[model samples]
Target: MNPVAVSIEDRVLALITEDELVSLTEALVAAGGENPGGTEEATVAVLEAFCLGAGLETLAEEAAPGRPNLTAVLRGGDRPGLLFLGHSDVVPAGEGWDRPPFEPYVRDGRLFGRGATDMKGGLAAVAVALKALKAAGVDLPGDITLACTVDEEDLGIGIRAYTRAHLGERFSGCVVAEPTDLGTVVGCRGDSYIDVTVHGRSAHSGRPADGLNAIDAAARIIALVREDHERLQQDQDALLGAGSWNVGLIEGGTGTSMVAGECRLSLDRRLMPDDNAARILESLRERIAEAGLERDGFAVSAAVTMEMPGFRTPEDHPLVADAVAALSDCGVASGIGGWTAACDGGFIARDFGVPTIVMGPGGLNDQAHQVNESVSIAELVAAARAYALLCLRHSSPA
Candidate 1:
């Protein structure tokens, strides 16, 4: 495939207007695709309708009931395609906001809403970028696919199921439009949810010495886990820094007068690309054993509830280079970076065997689920331009 002898950048920029981008983002923010009780159906409809109006082929498939993953494709070049991926779901809008969480509003040049900075804004930018490319009338070297998945905040069934269905498809590269504040994220830490249960005997308050206290055993386990967390800090990755763990929740003890029978602990552990949940759990169990928790009356068991793998793309990868160049073209000064929090890109990179980068508008490490989560309008426009340029630069055949 011969390269089209035209500068596709200017054409793409010209077609991606600020007004439409803001309007699209505002509408999406208003849709409230908050997870927990999903409403991705409505958000998917909005994105699919926008894609259809832009003369792109659109598909909406539910990862689960009412949780739809939306995809749009613009066939341009015949080379291996590029996928622009993002999530339609946002974390539930909790409390303490200047305005209503779902009521989209703009003030001081920032779009304030629940999904504004986290991803919905980025999703809109990618959609408009594709529309701009289509409107530019430039021949692309390969196809461009824009996918908005559901349930990214929770279990990530959206991307997992989508990848399971499209595993045979090949892409030269993928860019997850996760909020990077216009920077490119080359790697991220993975996450795991773990449960630790400590079992013991219950007895009356007067006979406390006769029965072992599960909460006491749990406290010992927590101390050992904290030691494990500190120990992991010594094994750090250059990009992701270091692995860490936190005991997020703990529950036990039925009454103040009786000895606690059982204790349950929920933990969140961050992993490097090379780490796995099984190994981490094994390490925790070892720690428990070292703490002398496995005895006649006291026993501890650890189970992994969820595990998401992490990934890192080398700086020389074509996908990363092209993204950096595109950001440069957009007059955005960006360098390769890493994300402390995991994202759906990890799934794409791990399962699909595609080099994936996290890049988008908004703050580099912006607070997404917090009260008054907002994104800069100017940054979003820049992100749109950057996405358009990246598609032309990376997806086109040399």
Candidate 2:
């Protein structure tokens, strides 16, 4: 620790500079393009180089081959440190961009490219913030670590591996640099992906009565889910409200001439911060059984495929207060709110025993994963300044 008790200015710092911020964001967006379950190696390589080039102490651990999680640690002073979290992968750029998706460009004060808003841009912000804070000779109250993971857009294996490894560690606070458009999100809904499979005997459509009719059984499950959804509406939380359900996909039937033997329903269940995924699944199973799907030689099974836990911190908690204050200090208008969408930060808060908040720059609803995805240059810089200020204000001055 340098032991320099200094206040960060509202304006962009001269150390790392704004040009570097923009440049880094562009490089990250370009190298970070990944389809769901695809390689994040290219993006990880670029980030590792940036960390090493900045002379920050860094480590790269592979969550899987070609999927790496990075931790760039800036050793500070004392216990109960702060953790900065982010993901390196982005949804694939499918179609509709004024320019090439990987060819990052800035116009009208916005940086446009895939991953500009959803994340890659936020990753650059943390990298720039840590680099500038170190160069400015500010002493930290505790160790500040930036852990960027992979597969956030898909299975979330990166964060899962990370949390399991650090189970014994502790942190005072965590900041997930997801694109929240400068809002300090204190609570967020968790999410789970479920696969509901219904099995029955296949028979010729000409004599459909010979088969148990899997498609018909599956419909009953969907109906049960619909009723539960309405019940959720009756009970709501101020921050996270009630969890919602969506049956996104349905596949069944081998051919029109035959009765469907197997049908699968892909469901999305959003959870309140306090909801348990396992229990939720059990309830759904019970509903299916009580709905009587298994009555006439029909079997219905629901299994959880993927899970992202939700989290909530009190509004008056010091972490939330410090985050709001930091955003205000950076000349950004920000307030505490709840996110309808889920993020990797939930894992840190729930699993690491760290009170976490989600805050960053970029449009969550509008720009993230959209065509010509982009983030305001000013917002990007403000986020960098905010993270640095949060670290300073959160830790006791030396």
Winner by TM-score: 2
For candidate 1, report its TM-score: 0.94
Candidate 1 global Cα RMSD: 2.2
RMSD of 2: 2.4
Q: Which stretches in model 2 have alpha-carbon errors above 4 Å? A: 1-12, 396-398
Question: Residue-wise lDDT of candidate 2 within 1-398, one digit each (tens)?
Answer: 23343334432255656798899999999895476856788888898898878767988888988778888988777776789999999998988789999899999999999999989888999999888877766666778889999899988999999998777866788999999999999999999999999999999999999997898888888998999999999998888788999999999989989999999999999988888889999999988878777877998888899999999988999988888888886788797899989999889988887788999889999999799999999999889988887877785323
Instruction: Give the CA lDDT, 0 to 100, for residue 369 in model 2.
Output: 77
- Show model 1 residue runs off by greater than 4 Å: 1-7, 364-366, 395-398
State the C-alpha lDDT per candidate. Answer: 0.86, 0.86
Deviation in Å, model 1, residue 254 alpha carbon? 1.1
Query: What does each candidate score in C-alpha RMSD?
Result: 2.2, 2.4
* lDDT for each residue of candidate 1 in 207-234, tens digit (9 for 90 to 100): 9998889999999988887888888889
Tell me the lDDT of candidate 1. Answer: 0.86
